[model samples]
Target: MLTQDSMPPSAKAIETAEDLSSIAFGFMASKALFAGLHVDIFSALADGPKSAEELAGAADIPINRIVMLTTALASVGLLTIGDDKKVQNSPAAQSFLSKQTKYDFGDYLRYQIDQQMYPFLLQLNAVMKGDLSDDAIASYRHWMADEEQASVYSESQHAGSLGPGRTLARKVDLATASTLLDVGGGTGAMTISLCREYPNLQATIIDFPNVTEIGWRFISEADLVDRVRYIPGNAVEVQWPGNQDAILMSYLMSGVPGDNVEELVHKAFDALAPGGKLMVHDFMVEEDRRGPALAALWQLQHMAFTPDAHSLSVGWLTQTGKRIGFDVDQVDNLIPAMTKLVVFSKPS
Candidate 1:
C-alpha cells in the first residue's frame, strides 16, 4: 500500500525560516512571474541576453519600468542579470516559460491561474465558511457550461496537460492496447499524447461539449482526428464508450465530489474489458496529509471554487481500486511532487 512514510523527500512540509518566508510572500512571487509573462520578459530574452534598455525597447516599456519588473523576476529566480547588466532567462524559465521553447507552458499560468483561478480565489474565505451560495462555490461547472470560459480554461489546461501527457506516454506502456477511454479528457491532451506514443492506439475522450469543441481543434492540429474522438457530456452522467483496453482519468478525481470518486473508479473498472488497465493521474496528498505543499495547495485552490472536491491520497485510491475488484499494479509520481499516477489492472 502507498504510505506517507514512504513518500519522497520532496513531499515533506516546510520547516525552515526561508520556507516560511517564501510561503508568506508566495502571492507576490506568483504575480511577479505573471507580470514577467505578461510583458514577454522571458520571450524577449529568448534570442539572446539583452540590456535593460534593449528589453524596454522590445517590450515597448520604459527602461526604468523594465528594470523594476526584471528585478522582481530576478528575485523570483526566473531571470538573471549579469555583472554586464544584460538580462537573460534562467534555465527553467527558458525551457518552460519562454514561448520560444516547444515545452512552453506559460499559458497554463497566464490564463488559468492569473485570469481565472486567481480572481475566484478572493472568495475562498467566504466559501469555506459556507457564507457563499452553492452557485458561487460551484462556479467551475458554470464556467464549463459557458463557451468562452470553457474555451479559455480548456486551452490553458491543454497546455499544462501536454507536458504531463508526454511524461505519461513515456511511463505507461500501451503498445498492446488498441483502445483507450479518456475520462474527463480536457482538449484531448492525454489522448493525443497516447495516440502519438502508440501508433495503433485509438481513443475516445469524454468531457463537456464546449471542451470537446476545443479538443477537436487540438486533435486535428495533431493530425490524430482519425484515431481520436470525443463524447461530450459529464463523465459521471454520460454514457462512457466502454469495452476498452485502457482507461485514463488524468486530473479528474480531484475535481469531483469525494462521494463520487469511488463510484467513478468503479465505473472505470466496469467500463474496462477484462485485463484492461486503468490509470488515474491527479494532485494527491500523502496518507498523513502533512503535505507536499504544492499538492495540498492545489487541492485547497480547487476547494475554494469546488465545494465538494475531494483531497485524494495514495492510500485512499489503492483501497478503492482493490475494493472494486482491481489489482493495484503501480503507483508513482507523474508530475514529481504535484501529481501522482496510480495504475490498476482488472483480472482477465
Candidate 2:
C-alpha cells in the first residue's frame, strides 16, 4: 500500500507509467479541438447558448458525440456550460474560435489538418530516412500554389503586412519615399496594406507567377491596382528592378537555404537606391536556441519541408546586414510576443 511517507514500488511504477501515457496521448486533445473547429461548433454557439442536443442539431454532429465533444472543449476552457447544462462560447472562443469573427482561427486549424498533420504523420519514416520523396515535393508545391485556400500559408504572409504596414505608414517618413519593392510578398497583402496606409507609396510585389495571380486578385479586390504592381518571377534569379526607395522581404528568407539567404540579402543591398531601407520580417531564434519554443519547433518544420532551410538568430542577421553595407536597427516586435523585425538602411 502507498502511504504519505513511502509508496509501494508497484504503485509508484504505475503512477509513472500513467504520467508517460498521458504525455504520449497529448495529441488526442489537439485532434479533438481540431475536429470541433473543422465542424464549426464554436460558430454555431456564437449566436446564443444551447444544450448538447441543440448544438448537435445545429452543427450536424452525431447526437451521441455532442456531449463528449462539448465537455472536452469545455474542460479545455474553450467553452462554458452552466449548471443548467447550457453551453456557450467562452470569451477566448468567441473572439478567435468562432468562424463568424474576423480573428477566427478555424481556417488555420483546417489548414493544419489538411496540409500538415496527416502527411507529417505518414511521412515520418521518409523524413527520418533523409529522403525527399516525390510525394513530399508534390505536397510542398501544392501548398505554395494553394495560398488562396491554405489558411496557414495566407496567415503567415498576412502576418508581415499586419504589423509593418501599419507601422511603416505611421512611423516611416513616406512623403519623401517614391518606390517600394515587396520581395516574396505573397498575395500582395503587404503591398495592399501599405498602399492603403500610404497614398504616395507605389509598391511592387515579386513572387512566383501562380502566386502573383492571387496577389493580383487581392490587389484588384482592395482597389489597389493603381498603386500596386505585380512582377511574376523568381525572387533569387531576377534582377531586382533596382532604384527602389525601400524593399520589404517578409517571412521569405527562413524558407530558403542559408547560403541562398545570404545571396538574396546581398542582392537586395545591390538593388537599393541611396538611403533606401530593407525590412526583413521572419522567425528569429534566440541566441541560446533554448527558449522561445515556437521558433525552435518551426526550425525543425522548415528543415523537414524546405531544402536547407533553418531560422537565423537576430544577432546573426544584424551582423550579416552590417557586413552587406547596411546600417541595421532591430525594429519593434510586430506580433508583440512572437517575432522581431530587422530594418537595414543603405548609405545615402
Candidate 3:
C-alpha cells in the first residue's frame, strides 16, 4: 500500500515537494553567494561588464573557477551574462552587493551571515544538546564577551541594520519625547537614525563595553554626539533612567535566552513612565507562525548558536503587553525581510 509508485502524488503535492527540495538545497545558493562575496566578485564587476577571463584576472582566480562561479552567480540573478558572455551586475547586485555602491551591504554578508552564522550550522547538534560550557564554545554570550569579536559583530550587524533603521525612524515618531533609552543598541545605528529624524530627541544607548566604543563612533558619524550617549552594562541589570517617555529594545529580546523575555518585558515596563512608550523591534512571523521562510529558518539557525533565538510574533507580544498593563500597536514590514516593530504604551 505504501509502495512509491502505487500512490501517485497530485500535481499540487508534486509542486510542493519540489519547493521543499529547493528549500533543502537552499544552503547551496547561500554558499554560492558567500563564495562570490569571498572573492569580491561583484565589486570586481562594479565599474562595468567583464568576460570570465577578465574577472579571473581582476579577482586573481583561475578562469575555470571564475566561469564556474559566474555561472552560479547568474543562476541567482546576481550577475547577468550578455550575448557575448560578458558578466555584469543585475540591478539588485549592483545596488547592495557591489562594494562601490552607497548602499553596499556586501560586508554584512561577508562577516555576519557568511562568516559568523553559517558555520554555526555545523554545531547544530551540539547546540541542541545545550551542554557546552559558556567558555567551551562560541555561543552568542561567549562571542559578545570578546571585545574583538564584539567589534566585528557590531560593525557587521550595523551594516545590515542601516536600511531598517531608516524605515523604523519613519514609522515611529519621537517628536514629543525628549529623552529616550536604547537598550542593547549595539553601535547605536537605530539611535543615530532616530536622532537624525527628531533633532529634539536626546537618546542614550546601553550595550556591552565591547560595543560602546563602536556605538560612539556611529553616533559621532551622525554628528549627534551631543544628543546621543552610551551606557556600558548588561541591559537587564543596568540602572534604567527613570521617567523616560520612550524606550527601544531592538533585537534585544531575540538575542537573549527565551526564558529571559518575560522578565525583560517586565523590566522594561517597570522602567518606563506611566505614559512612556516601549518599542520592540525584532524578527517576527505570522500568527500561525508559518511562512516568511527566512525568519522561520533563522530561528532554527539561531538555535545552533544561542539558547533562544527564535522570532517573536506580534500577536504574542500584544497579549504579553496587555498582560503587563500596556496597549500594543505594531508596524509590519519595517525591514520586510526579517524584522517587525511593535510599540507598547503604558497607560497614564
TM-score of each: 0.95, 0.83, 0.91
lDDT of 2 by residue, 30-118 (tens): 77778787788889998989999898898888988999898888887888999999999999889877878766656656665445644
- Encode model 3's per-residue lDDT on 136-229: one tens digit a residue: 5665556778887898889999998888888889998778889889999999888888888888898988988888987788888888988988
Task: In angstroms, give how far residue 212 of model 1 lies from its true place.
Answer: 0.6
Output the lDDT of residue 76, model 3: 78
In Å, residue 271's CA in model 2 sits off its true spot by 1.4
Given candidate 1, what's the lDDT at residue 306?
78
Q: Rank the candidates by lDDT, best first.
A: 1, 3, 2
Worst 10 residues of 3 by lDDT: 1-10
lDDT of 1: 0.89
Distance from true location, Cα of 188 in model 1, Å: 0.9
Instruction: Indicate the residue-level lDDT of 309 in model 1.
Output: 81
| Candidate with best TM-score | 1
Against the unseen true structure, what C-alpha lDDT does each candidate score? 0.89, 0.72, 0.82
- Please report, as a residue range, the 10-residue window in candidate 2 with the lowest summed lDDT: 1-10
Task: Please give the distance, in angstroms, between residue 244's alpha carbon in candidate 1 and its true position after superposition.
Answer: 1.1
Candidate 1 per-residue lDDT over residues 1-348, each given as its tens digit: 345466766545669999889778889989999988888888889998999999999999998899999998898789999999899999999999999899999989999989888988887899788898866765445679988889889999999989899999999888889999999999988898899999999999999999998899999999997899889888888888778999999988888777788999989998999999999999998887877778899999887877778889988989989998999898988887789999999999
Off by over 4 Å in 1: 1-6, 10-19
Number of the top-ranking candidate, with lDDT as the measure: 1
Question: For candidate 3, what is the lDDT?
Answer: 0.82
